[model samples]
Target: MSRPVSTYRVQLTPDFGFAEVAKIAPYLRDLGVSHVYLSPVLQAVPGSLHGYDVVDHSRIRQEFGGAQGFREMAGVLAAHDLAVVVDIVPNHMNTANAQFLSVLEEGAASPYADWFDIEWREGKVIVHRFADDLPQSEHYTVVDWREGPGYRRFFDVSSLIGLRVEDPAVFFATHEVIFWLLDEGLVEGLRIDHPDGLADPRRYLDMLRDRSGGVWTVVEKILIGDERLPDDWACDGTTGYDVLNRVNGLFVDPEGRQPLVALFTAMTGQDADYHAVMARSKRDVIDLFFRSEVERLARVAGASVQDLVDLLVEMPVYRAYVTPGEPVDPVARRIVESAAPNPEIARAVLYGSPEAVVRFQQTCGPVMAKGVEDTALYRWYPLACLNEVGGEPDRFGLSVEDFHDFCAGMRPFTMTTLSTHDTKRSEDVRARLQVLSELPGEWAEAVRGWSRQVSFDPHLDYLAWQTLMAAWPISAERFTDYLLKAAREAKTATSWIAQDHAYEEGLRAFAAKAVELPIGDFTALVDRHAVANSLGQKLVQLMMPGVPDVYQGNERTDFSLVDPDNRRPVSFPCAPNSAWDEAKLQVTTQALRLRRRLGPDAPYEPMAAEGEAAEHAIAFGRGRAVAVATRLPVRLAARGGWGATSLTLPHGSWRDLLTGGLYSGRTPLAHLLSRHPVALLERHDL
Candidate 1:
């Protein structure tokens, strides 16, 4: 199995395809990444911006230069000594898929009938096309759009139908192209998308491992707090939301929990408890979007629909990892019993019904995604940065001891990332937002003033204020799009399904006014500290015990927000336009190059600081390389700035990779970080 020393994520779209990737091969090599990680490369829905909605499994996307172009691109990357890691979406595919279309056209008689997870009744399939005038098919019936589809869909998205990958025939058919690429050595590794949606994630992974010769792979599994990946799964590890949340938590100030919560609750008139908000959001989604999934689970479990809904809403983690026909893992059993509405249901799920168990496990992921990440995160954000995917907003900060513990246990080959196309905000934006935790009073004042100038809906105004400050100097158009998306996702005044035009107009108008408001001074104030947090977190993430991934253009600074916003085209051969940009670029390049040199086998050793400000510093040694970063810069500055704080190096002359400064023995924190808030030091003797 091959593992990358580090990876650089590139979002491949029609505009930026294989040729574009080929053009960047030399640059990516120079950027010091062992692999170039790409988004989904298979054929997808037409004009798709992000290609997760794959339509064909047999061919490369023509819009992205097809098979020949991909071959050329791979060759170019190989010339540059850069391996490839392709993201494969095995959980679902676009409804436009030929196999799915065949099933629709021919129904039960189609050769691909078993390829999808469709419900059959009396040899006829029932589908909800969201239209009254359904297309006439002899073996299928179209019902109300709100009704459950005949087939399992991806997270309420009707267009992306689920794949029954647990079937041996379906698995082989869908993975043929991927296996061919793997055998040809065009792709060295794999990133499996949404393994939770599969009927049996562990079984699917075992098959994947056996077939692919156990090449390096990581699943895009979102692990909640203290939820470890199952030991049976045959992947390297998760795609690193666990690491992301921990690292992000290091910068948050725990002291800000109360004041921030108070301010948010007062302004929004909502409950201060994040879990309560989350539960309400879960129930709302169950009532609105996930009714189909709930109904199906209830039918399979032979339980009441309401009981299943209640249990799903109470589920703390994405899934319990329950495997049928085997003794339930104690941890998984505990999770289900705790979340189940009653003991009988828990027994039914854990011991009795295999169909019920599988359906329940599969449904948990979509419900959590829609309810928590999409809805609750948008609704009850005391500190917007903590509302990230797999993040708990109420859990404010992580102690240095805890973060070190997490890193100590991390699988070294698992990918760690800061920003991605799916991130709610860029790393830099979150860095900016983290500043609020240290200065809640000022942030509240700023929001109050902004609200007086232009207020939209109370439910969304606080988020808008935070967005404006974090993504400062944002264009009105971009901000409006984000705000609109936030509102709809929140499902408060307006939503994607039931658009309230009048409220939407108010939102747009408020966004326009918010952009024009005098918020630059406050943003500048936060940015002064944000620069420190940004550099510190970037350095820590890069040097941590995992394959760090630098999302495109994030090596410098990017304040993009959410999907289409985060997925904008990135320009290469770019130069730093600001001092902050220069510092971040230097930090990114130096750390990446150092990690590349150290390789993946370096051991991590935590280094403690000595003095009154010791808690503000996070230092770690990875063999000959050492990383030191400042956490909670606002509070650090307030406490008289690293006075008397010092770190004992490993008895060798060291050179600061960022500043090229020399150090030896015990180094004072003030002198070590005089030039920049973060330092990447390599032993000079080495």
Candidate 2:
């Protein structure tokens, strides 16, 4: 397997693409990255910033400079010895894609009808934007759009159509461009997007492996609490949410669990159960976002499919893999089998058939994506930092032993990252929020005071306060947009399709008041804590057992919120704050260089610290390289700043890579870390 020691994630769009990336290849190489991991480069919606919503899979997106631009970029990367890995959106295609348009224009007679996962039982393809088909006369007909048109789509996106990739012809047709790119050596590996949305993720991966000649690959799989990736999948591993959640778990102060919960309960004035909230959210998604799916499935079942809807709504994981030839997993089988249990013959009408089972399996993805990711995550208000993809915010923290075990097991195949385009908050934002645990009393006091100034849904209010506090130097417009998206996703007071004007007005008012709030002290607090966390987490991820991929601007103090905001341009112009980012970049470059030199397959061992600040430090060693990062800077200060804390290291003179200081076996961690929040040490003679 060809694995990159360090990968840099680039969000390719009309604004930044092949030309710009090629220009930066030397800079990235100098920054010590072994590869460039990129967003989808295929033709997509004209101005799509993040290119997951692809329209044409057969050609390179012209907005990003087309095939020639891609070749030029690849040449530059090869010149710098950097590998290329790109994201592929195979689960769905742009609704306006040629294949989908052909199906709409020609109906069942089109050669491309089978390419899409369309219901067709509705008799005609539902056209939303167009009036009719071309007057030149075609094989079939396109009709006017009707209310609640029946078709399959990507989540709630009306224009993104899901593909029937399970079909061999459809798979080959959709992946033709990707294969050509791989064969031509312009791209080396693939990052399969949203495999959970496919009928058989394992089968799709197997197909990808065979077609790509078994190049390195990882799925964009979100493994919720203890949900291990199936060992049978023919890919390297997941896109690393499994370990991303684990690494994020380390910063959480276990003691802050109740305080944050209690604060949330007090602010919201509702003792909302998480499971109950999730159930309601999922049901909302089923009834509103995916109503057409349920209605279509009902047509297939030849009756009301409320029973199947319930079965799908209650599914614990994403879509179950129900393949044609592969052996059915007993656990997956039980989930479906239990949902449609009927030994009696009359009951066979509902779900005894395989077709009903297939529809149910397909419905699970849209439901889970809308429910957990869109709704529940926004409604969840404990500590927003813990509310990351594949991370359970309810689960407070993981022990050092469990963290080490997780890394050791999933090291080689997994791609670990602290921040991504989809994360709820940036790494610095999360780091500061984790500070709330150490200062629970202060946090509650601050939040209560902020409430008096501005008020909204308790859950939304709490999330907003923490987000603003993390990045208080934010613009008012940015704050309003962030809060509005949060409210719509939560569906507490308003939504995307519908809005409660009165409730929305209150949300907007709160955003305005928040901008006027006196947040200088809070901003200082966030900056100080974020510095410690930014260094600590970065060092750990670089040294941990995996191919670490750094999101574009996150090598510095990236206090960005979620998507669009996180995906903004990466710039480092000469400014007052340039020193701070430059320092972080220095640390990152040093760490990546060390990783390149030492290699990744190293023995793992956890280090113990002895001192008053023992609880505030985490230490681990990978071969001769040892990384120590400070955990709770707020708590450390409160308790007189790492009083007598010391970490025992491997004997012999060790040089600090970050700072040029030297140390031996028993070194005082506090004195050593006083200069910087993290230390990367290697033996004097490696």
Poorest stretch of ten by lDDT in candidate 2: 341-350
Tens digits of per-residue lDDT for model 2, 412-457: 7567788888888887788777777777888888888888877767
lDDT tens string, model 1, 1-686? 47888888999888999999999988888878889999999988888889998888999999999989989999999999899999999999987767876877798899999999998877787776733444577878777767777778899888788999999999999999899999999999999999999999999999999999989899999999998888778999988888888989999999999999999999999898888999999999888877877787778788888888888899999999888888888998898889888998888778868888899988889899999999999999999999888999999999999999999888878889888878899999999999999999999888898888898788998999999889988999999999999999999888898999999898889889889888899999999899999999999999999899899999998999998999999999546989999999889888888888897899999999999999999999999999999999999999899988999999889999988899999899999999999999999996
- Residue pairs clashing, model 1: none
TM-scores of all candidate predictions against the true structure? 0.99, 0.93
Q: How well does candidate 1 score on lDDT at residue 124?
A: 80
Instruction: Return the TM-score for candidate 2, rounded to 2 decimals.
Output: 0.93
- In candidate 1, stretches whose alpha carbon ends up further than 4 angstroms from where it belongs are 130-135
Q: In model 2, where do residues sit more than 4 Å from their true spots?
A: 130-149, 298-304, 322-327, 333-354, 456-459, 572-580
True-structure lDDT of candidate 1 = 0.90
